[model samples]
Target: MKSFRLFLIASLIFITNNFLFSQEEDVVEDSTETLEVYLIDNYLQGENEKILVLSWMTNLPTKSKVKIEEIGTFNVSDTLTDFHQTKIDLSNVRFTKNEYMFKIISELEDGSSVESEEYSFLVPFEEKDTSSTKSTTTSQQVKTSSSYYIYNFALGITLWLLPSPALAFENNKTKFAILKDLPLVSIGSFSAYKTFPYVYFYAGYVHIPEGFVKNSFRLGTKYLYELPEIKHFVSLGLGGFTNFKGSNGINGEIGFSFLKVLKTFEMTASYSYNYLPSSKNKFHLFSIGLFTSSFSINLNY
Candidate 1:
């Protein structure tokens, strides 16, 4: 009995020691500082003296600075933020080397710091033949412009090919609706512009199952302010409507739409206020359907 008790006590002690060690390891891992930074985009900008534009985002809210080897460190943000975009002037720095290595250092209020992996950028070399360079650049710009229009054309053909359904309300009357969008044209460059002017044709039908089962048809033109990052749009529309039971009249509408990006097509939820001048009628409309435009509109300008 004494020997058995000794073995049991030793086994319990061994299990307890392992459990305590595991707990300590967990604590250490949890307390470790972690921060990650990602590069969004970069470019060179200037009319006379060029500047390097570096934009990056962090996983955590931190006051961050970027350190370039040979060149001095540049401050990015004074307050803690997850997004950081800054322009670093390279006018004074001598480009003795072709490339330079840089890293992002992020520090929290508690003085805990973390660093990103080293990144490098190459300096752009100047062209010798100015006349040839200008001609080449002009040709490239023309090709880019053509590609932009072609892309939007293909997108219009594929995405807005089908008309979807919606729910509409007018004068406290609810009706089932069929909606279609014919995108006329879109104007903006993907890289340089944040907002795009979109012109499209809008058509819809409201079906009412009363008396003779009246059908109301509306045809309109819509002008929209498209915001790509926020995935939303604001629109103004003017059209004429004809009812099988009532008289024809002119109507105006203001609409707001939210866009959801999907693999094949973008889904849209829209709300609008509509007014008719002839009948003195006012209505609110809500629609949920696929949009003719993508949330990420590819452009070059």
Candidate 2:
């Protein structure tokens, strides 16, 4: 009877001590604050003042600064903190046509540091003739686009005569690479190439892509150009292939194109070259296919 009573007393004491400790731990955890700084307000003010107001909120008192990374950490400026607002006085560097990029760095009194996201602001030039400036900008944008791209379409064929591994300069080997020659009925012999806002299909075989498939398919887009007066078009494209003779290699196509005006049916007859830099075998393909006129548009803002 005496032993049973002592055991019961010890059990009660143990339970009480554990409960008290657990409650104390919970209190300590709840007292800890989360380290966070949120940019609640950002704006510019004052012609004479030329001040930038970046207001932020935090759960604890913090010593804060800004880090500007143009090439490296070029500037670290102190902030005038009042409650939540940080006043950046632009009195030193008044009117300039340079964009200022900055990130907020805050160190709490609790020895924890937090960094805000990088932000940028630029003061656009004060133009004399805003309307003429707009017109010139629009014309320049159009000229830039036309210089880079022209709409053209063609039907073409590709041949995979040479097989090579898709090995980069590194020593690692490609996973899905194959060796030896494949019959004429291979994937790369036929392919459907598409671009923005248009779809075209091919009865040709789909080309086995090397290195990267997305990069290979988009190579055609870069080559699109048309001489609308003569209905003549030309394209130059290249793509990588995997499992080419148990290795990876690239293939290229050069297309001479034509389009029927009224119907606008596109056609391309291309000469394709397939070779492996590491191997001696070379393959040539003669391909012709029908497609639609390439589409292009220009935008001004």
Candidate 3:
């Protein structure tokens, strides 16, 4: 009878050990799969200050914590029980135009700890003031003005500079065809911050000329560096282009752009020199033009 009792106790001990080991293994797996947190705002504006929202999930009910440290400081922790909404105010934090990294850690009820992926938010400030009064005035002006006038103004300047029908004729015959190779158009959305550098995306017609008006469409990226005291920025961009005239060529350009962001309107002037190595027949077909000089009204969304 004593031997039988001893055997039963040993069996129970083995089963209990196995169950505890399995539980530990499950906890390890859960800790490895951490929660994800991200910044909601794509473009942060100065007037409407933005906040960092943290999100997470767990297999079991667990208490979590979030911490934010400015680029170079000790991590600060905040305990989070409710997983619904977590907010961090970034109003006073200042940053230059560079990558800002934040660390977040979450703790589980079982003493297992998990950390989030390194998340970054590009907080940008507009050098231009975005106010309702300025927007109203600009809106009225745009509604009253005709878009045709704007188009005509741009076309008229382009024609007046060259002023030769023969120039257009030559362009059609040679690889330098404007009509066949329509200048690539790009619609860009850009935002700037007073404390941070600015970013812009090119989507529409970005006129790229190789020599004697060779038209090409391109997708490009631009970065603007904010200067102290000055509202203008030094811009840099690089991108790829394909000619539409079936010329089969690729082009790259780099240039500097300046912006004067006013209370209501913004004026931008950019000068980029493009190089088309493929267009070089006998000599390198190198052409330089005033790439862009235009004015736009600031839009709020």
Model 1 CA lDDT for position 163: 56
**Among these predicted structures, which one has the highest TM-score?**
1
lDDT of 2 by residue, 1-301 (tens): 9999999999999999999999999999999877666666565555446566776665556677666554333223243232355566665563444466777777766656678777765532233465565421111111245533332222111222223332221123232332222221111111011121221221122333343221222122224554546756676665655443454456776766664423544555666665656654444555555444222231111
Can you write out model 3's per-residue Cα lDDT over 131-173, one digit (the tens) per residue?
A: 5333321111123368777886777455324311111122334
| 69: Cα error in model 1, Å | 1.9
Q: Estimate each model's TM-score.
A: 0.47, 0.29, 0.29
Give candidate 2 misplaced runs (Cα > 4 Å).
40-53, 70-102, 117-301
lDDT of candidates 1 onward, in order: 0.66, 0.47, 0.44
- Candidate 3, RMSD to the unseen true structure: 17.3
Q: Give the TM-score of candidate 3.
A: 0.29
Runs off by more than 4 Å, candidate 3: 1-197, 206-213, 248-265, 281-301
Scored against the true structure, residue 182 in model 1 reaches a CA lDDT of: 49
Runs with alpha carbons beyond 4 Å of true place in candidate 1: 1-11, 30-33, 125-167, 170-267, 270-284, 288-301
Question: For candidate 1, what is the lDDT?
Answer: 0.66
Query: Predicted candidate 2: what Cα RMSD to the true structure?
Result: 20.3
Please identify which of the two predictions, 2 or 3, would achieve the higher lDDT against the true structure: 2
